[model samples]
Target: MLDSGLYEQLHKALWVQKKLSETVARHWVTTEYQGLTLSSHFQPIFSISHRRPVGYEGLLRASTDSGALIPPPAVLVLPNNSKENLELDRACRQLHLQNFARQETGDCWLFLNLNSQCLVTEQPDAGFMNRLFETTGIHPSRLVIEILESEITDRSYLKQLIKHFRSLGCLIAIDDFGAGHSNFDRIWELEPDIVKIDRSLVQEAGKSSRVERILTGIVSLIHEAGSLVVLEGVETRREALVSIAANADMVQGFYFAKPQQLISSNHEEFVSVIDELLQHQQRQRFKNTHQINENFRKIERLFKRAINHFSVTQNFEESSEILFAEKRSVRCYLLDDAGYQMARNIYSPHYQQTMDVRFTPLLSGDNANWSHKHYHFRAVQHPGQMQLSRPYLSVADSRMCITVSQTVTSSDKQFVFCCDLDWQDN
Candidate 1:
């Protein structure tokens, strides 16, 4: 009894609904790679601050007909055919989307790995991803595309691809950072939401104090760049502690949980572990700070007493000898307001004897201008206040030393008193 126009519209609506249903059904269909079924296993990525799992990385794994597992590399290997590689990549992504839906992991992001070479070379089907998202019910915003850092060669193409992904509401991450000629310039251009420090760096950091310091510095830089850092490959308590000390935003590795068929159910245990590590770090920091403050106070008192004596002494050389006996100072000199040395340096006898012949040029620094030195300018600004310079190799002895400078007035003439202290002894 409906009008002709209404009947035609209703029939079209029904047909469209049928087609949408078919597309949704097709999204769940599994793909086979070399007669093996592909599936996804998720590894949880935890937030150090929150002490909870913020998201999961979907790792692709294949299973044979006999139910034997196939490693990811084996499944991903393509025989020099771009078409096959693209197909495999699509299949892996689809599998991840399907499994994510099946697992019901709650409002958490799914980090999916994208091959940089594939993305750079292939012209991706725009509608294909739109259809997949629509059919699978996985929103683009909840997905994070992690690109391997080493594989990217053509940055222009990569930037365009990243823009395309972002337009779809997906976040970007640079994985395996600090490995294989990692470029900070490119990273800043990419402006990724996350940077995963390579496992090798994390492992080396745990084993070497120097490497740990470097890792910490790297993490600090990454944070300054407006991105989160994930210290990957933490396999022991020491490694986790190292990551925490580095101030990593997140930590992931076997120490927490290995990549398994299902997301980890032991969230409480991991949280406890993180809390314990944070407590230990806090205690250690408090102890170190207290000790350092005490040491600084002692050093200040020593310098103040020495300066009082030096100001009162009529014989400068005798006072210098007394000061050198009490403190492990290398040399002391007087400089005018213009940063030109006013007198010869009073070098410690023991230090002078050990000085390298190659550095004899430094001994004749009287009347030399030091206006370019940071300590000179800083001391001028804060007259009568002591300023310390960071440790640097001394030009006189080729040994590490710290420079301390103080601007003082004697008989209405302002002069800067500069002293060098052995860094190791200090």
Candidate 2:
């Protein structure tokens, strides 16, 4: 083991690194990313899918007062000094405003790492955030306060802090989620707007099912609670695609763009990239919409014909084969009034297993039983509601889809029919 002198020396070395990071962060206004001279120190890496604003993550890189880009992460891990951390945060905010102004974009929130000490000091300067907003001309709505999950985090105060930020019109985010031992339960208590999946959890998405399951559970849990997920530190198309398929609302990683002291210009190239994504989304959307419309029309026609079938013998074994059997892909299920499974198309891969399925989750809505699923033609729609299940991958075919449940009442007796729509086959 090292002696006290060596330990002290190491601490001093850490402080030196800390000071260098501050120097670099202080120069954030002059950092460049991909040749785009960011007028600010904080750089935002975004999702390539919808061009929707994710969060602007602060990067502690600095082009020298001498013009050299200081490395990141090390700058952050040098030493956890509260005062220094606060200063770093402030400088990051300043640079964040500068970059916000340059982009001519107003919706993306700037996610500045927060110093836990600064939060619990019982000394929130009322004007601090407002002034930062005023200086940056970034609206409070466009600011997200990012709290790193550290040992010192106190859940009670964290809740208070998140509520306080929200009171100021700013959003709250939990950064580096699932990386450390902090209480993720606070996320639910605080009701934050964003829950960023830590890079470590996302790093081995391809090789480790264990990693993927953990990542899946984290993302799914956050999404279930109504918060958006940003798959942070995405480094590969595979990672991004997997996260996207898992329903992540946003993604950030080096593959998209690395943090730089300066941002790359050539707006034309960025614009073209944006255009291509938009066109692809548009076409995909069109195809999905067309498929759903055709299904709806077919369903309407089938339902009119099936009304006689519904009124007759409840078991579809004979008539369904005579009617929908020719249609191949369409699926249907029946549930009794007591929430028990009934029957469905014999060909349905899941036929007769159970009326209540696992793939879709139902939610309550305007009608006693109406819900929506995400579809190609429509991002979300209730169609005709029985008990609407949110979208999920169908277990039978492993395809993205949603199931709609509705009750058909003849003379006050109610019977439920749940219809499933698969985007893959569509």
Q: Best candidate, TM-score-wise?
A: 1
Tens-place lDDT per residue, model 1, 62-90, is: 78899998888887775367777887888
Lowest summed lDDT over 10 consecutive residues: which window, candidate 2? 363-372
How many clashes does the backbone of model 2 have? 21
Clash number for each model: 0, 21
- Once fitted onto the true fold, the runs of candidate 2 whose alpha carbons sit more than 4 angstroms away are 1-42, 45-49, 52-55, 63-69, 72-81, 261-426
Query: What TM-score should be assigned to candidate 1?
Result: 0.78
lDDT values for all models: 0.80, 0.58
| Residue range 275-368, candidate 2, lDDT tens digits | 5655665676799679766756665555544444664655545434433532333365544455444553344443334334543343111122
Q: Estimate each model's TM-score.
A: 0.78, 0.53
Error of 2 at 350 (Å): 24
lDDT of candidate 2 at residue 185, scale 0 to 100: 74
Error of 1 at 275 (Å): 1.0
